[model samples]
Every structure is written in C-alpha cells, then in structure tokens.
Target: MTERQILLVKNSWSYVIVKSEEAGQLFYHRLFEIAPELKSLFKSEPKGQSRKLINMVTLMVSKLQKLDEIQGEIKSLATRHHKYGVDPAYYRIVGAAFLWTLQQGLKDKWNEELEEAWVDMYAVISNAMIKNQQAVAA
Candidate 1:
C-alpha cells in the first residue's frame, strides 16, 4: 500500500476505534444480514464474538506496515477459519459488510480515498487468507 493509503487507513480507523464495541456489533449485524448462512460459523456469543472481532482486526491493522511480522498469524487465522467452515467466497461479502460498517461509523469522514485504502487493505488481507486456506486444503 502507498504511504498515503496507509495514512488514510490509520487516520480513519482512529475515528472508528473510539466506539469499537458498537462498530464491532454493527459489523456482525451487517455480516449476518448479508449472509445469514454464515451465522452458524460463529461459535461465540454475540458480545464476546464482537469484542474478539474488534481485537483481532485492531491487531491486524496496527501491524499493517509490518505485515511480514504478522503473515504467519494471518495465515494461521486463515487456516483456523477454514476449519470453521468459512467459504473462501465469503471474504468478499465480509469486505462489503466491513466497508458498510465503516461508512456508518465514519459518517461524514468516509470518502473515496478512505474507501479505496480500506479496499486495498482488505484485498491484501483476504487474498492472503484465501491463499492460505487453499494451501491448507492441499
């Protein structure tokens, strides 16, 4: 990612993280709305799962610049997710729901640049996850 995009992601995330719990709940709600079938994949209670989601994504975003350090973690997450029965195609739906949740949280601050930066980041993360899933399958 470009420095500008990295900056955009960091800056925009600050706004959302302030209400991390709410944002996390919103994301799950949106995710379920988009793909109701996915609801069964989650084993944790809603609030707990919401907190976990925020925590994991927070760790992932915080280490974005040093992704080399987290590649193993990310791939392992993918492998665990694969075992949980997450379809690879569901990543795109998750991305959409995530962006929508961001838009809802960021409100006036959300824009093309921010959206693009997130799309770029999500693409990288999800592609890695999907690739790792494939590797694990093989």
Candidate 2:
C-alpha cells in the first residue's frame, strides 16, 4: 500500500474501532447473507467469532505498512483456515462483506478513494493467504 492509501485506511479504521462490535456483527451478517454455506466453517460462538474478526482486521490494518513483517503469521492463519476447508474463492465473498460493513460503518466518510484503498489492501492480504494455502497443498 502507498503511504496515502495507508493513511486513508488507518484514518477510516479509527472510526470503525469506535463501533467495532457493531461492525463485526454487520460483517458476519453480510458474510452469511452472501454465502450461508460458509457458516459451517466457523466453530466459535457468534460473539467470540465477531471479536476475532475485528481483532484480525485491526491487526492487519495496524500493520499495513509492515505486512512483510507479519507474513509468517499471515501464512499460519491461512494454513489454519485451509484446515477449516476455506476455499480461495471465499476470500472475495469475505472482501465484499468487509467493504460493505466498512461503508455502512463509516457512513459519510465512505468514498471512492477509501474504497479503493481497502480493496487494494484486501487484495494484498487475500492473495498472500491464497498463495500460502496453495504452497501448503503443494
């Protein structure tokens, strides 16, 4: 991510942190709505799962500039997700749910530039996860 993109993401995420719980609920609600079958992949209770989701997003956004530093951790996450039978295709669905949740959460602050930055960030993260998953399978 470019410095400007990182700034946009970080600034927007601050708003999200204020209402993290609702944002997480909205994310999962949208995710299940988009792909109900994915519900089976999650074993945790709703509240716990929501917390995990928000925590993961927070961690990723916080480390956006130093993503390389966390590649190992990201790969481990992908490996665990692969064990859960998470398909690479599901990443797009999750991205859509995430963007929608952010838009809903950010309200007036949502814009093309911010959307693009988030999309780019998601692409980077998802590609890393998918690549790691494929490597593990290989």
Whole-model Cα lDDT of every candidate shown, in order:
0.92, 0.93
Assess candidate 2 and give its TM-score to the true structure. 0.97
Candidate 2 residue-wise lDDT, 80-123, digit = tens? 99899999999999999999999999999999999999999999
Count of residue pairs whose backbone atoms collide, per candidate: 0, 0
Off by over 4 Å in 1: none
TM-scores of all candidate predictions against the true structure: 0.97, 0.97
